[model samples]
Target: MTAAPHRPPGAPTADGTEIEGRLDEAVRAVRAPDAVFALSQDGRRTVRCGGTAPPPPVPRDRLRYELGSASKPYTGLLLAELVRSGVVCGADPAVVHLGPGRPHPRRSAITLTHLITHTSGLPPLPRDFYRQGLPHWSTNPYAGYPAERVVRAFLRSRPAHRPGTRWRYSNFGASVLGHALAAATATPWEELLTERILEPLGLAATALAPAGRPDTDATGHRADGTTPVPPLLIGGFQAAGAVRATPHDLLSFLEAHLRPDGTPLDGALRTVQRPVLRRGLGHRHVHTLTWFRHPTDHGPMYFHAGATSGQQAFLGFRPDTATALAAVSTRRHTGRDAFVATAYGLLASLPPLDRE
Candidate 1:
């Protein structure tokens, strides 16, 4: 963590070297092969520090990192879009999109809200998902688990709790939600996401598949920082954790949450910010979409973190402070990784510069 926040040559910053130093320490502590950290306040001043994987080449703001579970918030945003568009109400049953038919066990009970809030009572994944993925294990666990299995598990499985009865983080629920949204909109899950959220937000660099983004690639890496790790391919669980994007794109997305406009999705964007569940005593410690809120002395910060086989990511924004932060790296975690800790630490340390 000794390296100063080394801003890439041409990248500019309004923040002092101390701010860059705070961010620099984290990137060093994590020893990421490739990484990016950016902070914005008052929607104007922005500063970024990047870490390169090996040598001569440097990490750029546009270098894509697998967003993993952080992508879930985007899924949540899409859910809000569907609700605002009248495709399905928050409380409507998932069966609503399955069309007219005798719904499978508990299928009629799961709602879009349940899926987004991770309270649908579904398991983390389908039963056979591992059977299909294990063979690919350290390779691409998700490659064989395709759209068919996602639909199969979602419809056939029975929920442990009546919809909305309990809160459990279920990748299966998020995955099913993606397909359900696609069904309602008559589009594929990826296409629906791109049209509704990515394109509108101008996250042009994000991609569901490696082939989709051909210009560059940041393959996931092991803790050693050299052994390449295969990406967690997007099978049917497109809504779960299969998206990748650059720090520049994520900051733009975060900026939108802080300062909304009179766009087509303003209503949906607003919905994504408001909390619905009482997860803790403070107003900020609730869940909205896939974002979890944490109260800071400065303000409440809404954020989420994600991990793939070889990548880790964090996305957080504090509305009361109008500050947003993001960090990503090719190096993955094993238990309590430094990257995750430093991200949360930075968020805690950054009291809105203009809050006074």
Candidate 2:
């Protein structure tokens, strides 16, 4: 709705415009009713466009979109804190914490790193998760499922691959990692996130709001683009993708990732951004603890996207250039190609990396 701040000296605006133009084209092509886009370089050279909803005169701050899987990095940060405090080991197998009572023997070998990198060999979702019907999965798949059920489902199923052997992008793995972090720290998952990640960073707007909040929540639209759905609440899987944040708060979070110095979790942030697995085509697919890395002519960039019943969002940063971009769409467009293209395009438009 508001224009982003002006670009600082020595930053490349031409490239930034090219990327923004591509995103604008995408929004137009999708005919999306509501969307928000924000870009920043070292917290300056920032720009934003679009609004909280489609047309017709409702102007609101662009903070109501659901952050979807982008919440993983926050979960990863909490896990990192546990590691820093010596309460948990990044490489420790899940079995070590869940204990012998847990069902899956394969899980015995799955490490925190595996969960963070999506290489834990877990399924994207539980097999019987759909038995409850489409509304359940579509609106709030995990809302009714309890943590005990998650442990049971995990133990009953076998790993899709050997631990740490491949990347399959499992939301289930992240949920398990969240539980494990809480277990190791002797704190509730939400409280652990608040105390360690949110409070320290002063991210007051970021958190899993319970069912109702009056502050500008975005409504998810159906494919036909008419129906509006309530925000999906994944009960036990809160850690996997349950965060609601504004673009400004998200930018603050991304800033910490891009520039971790002076942060409480700098060591953990460093670990989270370090590439662990190569995925996608050409093995150019780079992945760190929770963030996905994109190889660019400028340098290695990191990003992650989130989606839910009603929202889609993306965050990306070029470490070499200290540039970051974040975007949120109230409507879920089927595939992620546009989001990826936008991020890559934006990064490409930046000035060449300075080889120091």
Error of 1 at 191 (Å): 1.7
Candidate 2 residue-wise lDDT, 1-356, digit = tens: 22333344665444545655654665554444566666666565344455334552333234466787888888888877788888888899876766645455677789988887888889888787767636665566667887777766766668878898787888888888888777777888788899988989888877676436444576677544566767767777878887877777777888887778788888887887877788667888888877778776547778888878766788877776677777776666565335546545655566532222
lDDT of 1 by residue, 206-257 (tens): 8887753324556778877788886568678778998888787888888888
In terms of lDDT, the best-performing candidate is 1
Model 2 Cα displacement at 214 (Å)?
4.8
What's every prediction's RMSD, in angstroms? 6.4, 5.0
Candidate 2 lDDT (Cα, 0 to 1): 0.71
Flag regions of model 2 displaced more than 4 Å.
Answer: 1-30, 45-47, 51-59, 102-105, 133-135, 280-282, 335-340, 352-356
